[model samples]
Target: MSEGPLYPPPGAPTPEEPAAGPPAQPAHPAYPAPGTTPPPAGWAPYPGAAGGPRPGLALGAAHKPGAFALRPLGLGDMYDGAFRIIRFNPKATVGAAVLVTAAAMVLPLLVTAVLSFTVGLALDESGEIETSASTSEVLAFLAAYGSLLLSLVLAQIGITLVTGMIVHVTRAAAVGRRLSLGEAWAATRGNRWRLIGLVTFLYVAFVVVLVVYVLLWVLVVALADGPWPVVVWGLVSVPAYLALTCWMWVRVYYLAVPALMIESAGVFGAIGRGWVLTRRAFWRTFGIALLTVVIANVAGSMLGFPFSLVGQLATVFTPEYALLALVLTQAVVSVVQNAFTAPFTGAVASMQYLDLRMRKEAYDVELLREAGIISE
Candidate 1:
């Protein structure tokens, strides 16, 4: 060889080296460090992966595709995906929420106004301004309160119905599709009755719990020898009852709406499915549901705070129009808040439901197949 020696003396340039040339470059500088084995081709980090993804600057190579960015998400994926869906299909998702919110809000207010006017007329006619009010007056007051409660319940039902439509639209969006308002409504047609029935069941369950608690208090009042015993009984029973009620509600109905809407299950079937799916994942489901609600409430409160403050301030400066301003402010705030929150919440809940399906049934495989990422 034409080298100074077989190899140059320690650190000296060999015949293969170009003396005084530009610095040498690696063919693949991005390769793993010296003495380390490179990861297998196409390997990447994944949720619940074995030892996690190989350390590298490359993006996830093994993150299989789906309708959404990635299918079968982990907790964070589902949480983040909820908001993503909102952006993905705002018209169907947010528009539907806005429309439902408007109806749910305005109709209730109108009913309250008409009912209040009628009640006021009745009271004025009774001419009971002097002395104590009559039994009919007391009954009228109760009726007013009852109507208010009914309006609230109706509003809740409307929200729940809209939530079902939102889940429907989101599922379509997840499959690389969109739904028109009519299409979403049409999709929910088969499930509307089941949806109402499921909500009714939950309400009935809650009423039953309340009635049972009331009966227990009545018994305590009748049987207890002293006020101390009754007070003690109330103290012990109330918290326990409330805790049990909350736990039962979370476990039984966390997935009920999704099951009814997505799986097309019946009311009782949805309840049973929710119970089964939540059997081992109760806390996870509950945490997600609770987190969604808390976030929505916090966001809504933040958005409405300024408007509410304005309404309150206007009461002092413009007393004549304060009531109108407050009412309109509340309506506008509620509508805007619901528009954002309802769809986002529904999307989050539906993702949680999808997560359960993936964990329990490998639903991701089908999603991937539908997205053409896999065959058979």
Candidate 2:
């Protein structure tokens, strides 16, 4: 009977394949009703043998086809790429950072100490301290502090230049080119002092803004010592201070360094450029910068902690030896810390700049063209 029914089974459809043709649909059926549509031929609920979502078509998204594509970067890319750039060319990225950092730090300290001692000795020998203790001592103190300030400014300038070098080197490496320290310097050659000037200008601008805010508060207090002063402080000073600080540091100047280094922008140009680049992407850029700073600090602490502990321990037993050891250890740790951290910061900045350009200006296209990956 079953063998005979095998031929008679054409009368009704099985559960696996529904019967075709139009029919009255069921209100509450266990299966899809008659005339119900099926997926088109060669189609699927999901693509591929593994039944995963279709490539490029799933979720209305497209895949990036290559590495180092000039595209809007993800937070992970911004982060991981920071270390990737360092890994790509450690000699250039880390070496340049270490050397420049050492110079920037040690030179200033040396100059400040030597000049202070010299000024103190000269004042002592001239007997100027005895007659006019106030005047001579003030002069000596001013000279020492002035020298210190000068050295600090010089050190900052060196750091600015080093930042430029790091950007150039990391950027080059990102696009598959390794650079030497000299080559990285050359990439930012004519713009070294310009970068420094841009940084200094920004610093001055921030200070000016702070001073203006302070003066406004002072003026408000001088005009009214009562509730009016309290009202102004609450309504104007506090909110304005917070808003302007966030706007300037986080939104305005966050990308200025990269703009100056990568685009050869002037001081004011860099500020404007950074403002433009950070538009509508404040949180992402802020997150990137914040994460970079945290990572850098953590890494620096990790590197320096051992040396610091050893130095402190040694000092309890042998002071003179510990002093020498501590100096050497700190210098070594500083170099190591900067070597890793500087490139990461530089890479983060460069990545942010590139991502901004890619989003705003199709900068990846230009980069690809420059790298000969694409035709004009």
* Index of the highest-TM-score prediction: 1
lDDT digits (tens) for residues 144-263 of candidate 2: 445445644654565567788777655554444445455566567567777877777878889998899888877777788588666857786688787777778867777888877776
C-alpha lDDT of residue 107 in model 2: 46
Candidate with maximal lDDT: 1
lDDT of 1 by residue, 141-191 (tens): 555445445645666677788888887766654544445566566567767
lDDT of each: 0.63, 0.59
Candidate 2 has a TM-score of 0.65
Q: What is the lDDT of residue 371 in candidate 2?
A: 39
> Judged by lDDT against the true structure, how good is candidate 1?
0.63
